[model samples]
Target: MKHEMGRSDLLRRIQEVEFVALDINLYLDTHPDNMEALMDYNKYVYELDQLKRTYEMNYGPLLNFGFSPSQYPWRWIEEPWPWEI
Candidate 1:
C-alpha cells in the first residue's frame, strides 16, 4: 500500500532512518563479517537515499552537488521546523 505522508511524518521517518543507519553502522563495526547485518545496512542506506530524494524534491536540495548549492545553505529560512509538529 502507498502512504501519503505529510511533511512532519516524512521528517519523523527520516529521523528513524537516521537512527537505524547509525545503529547499523555500530553493529557492522563489531560484526563486520555478518552478511545479514551488512545486507540490512545496505537496504537501510537505499531507503535513506529514497527518503532524502523525496524530501529534496519537495523541499529543496539537502546536500551539495559539485555544481549545486551546499547543504543547509538556507538553514535559517523557517518553514515548519521538526518540532512544530
Candidate 2:
C-alpha cells in the first residue's frame, strides 16, 4: 500500500526533514558530546539531500545562485515560485 507523493507532498516532506535536521543542529551546538544526537542529525541530513534531489528531478531546482544547475532554456525561471508551491 505504497502511496506516490505529488509535488506539494514531496515538498512538505522535504520541509519536515529540513526542520528536524535544523532542530538537531541547534541541539548539537550546545551538546556536541552527544553521539546519538549527532547520528540522528546525519541521518536527517542525508534524507534531506535525497528528498531535495528527488524534488529537483521531478520538478525543478530548489535553489539558484549556482546552488542548482539548470538545463537548457533556463528551467529556474520556468518553474513556479516557492510561494506558488
Best by lDDT: 2
Query: Relative to the true structure, how large is the alpha-carbon lDDT of every model?
Result: 0.71, 0.84
Per-residue lDDT of candidate 1, residues 17-82 (tens digit): 889989999999999999999999999888887886676656654544442232456642445544
lDDT of each residue in 1-85, candidate 2, tens digit only: 1226888888899889999999999999999999999999999998888888887776778888998776676778874754478
Provide the lowest-lDDT 10-residue window in model 2: 1-10
Assess every candidate by TM-score. 0.72, 0.89
Using TM-score as the measure, the top candidate is 2
Clashes of 2: 0
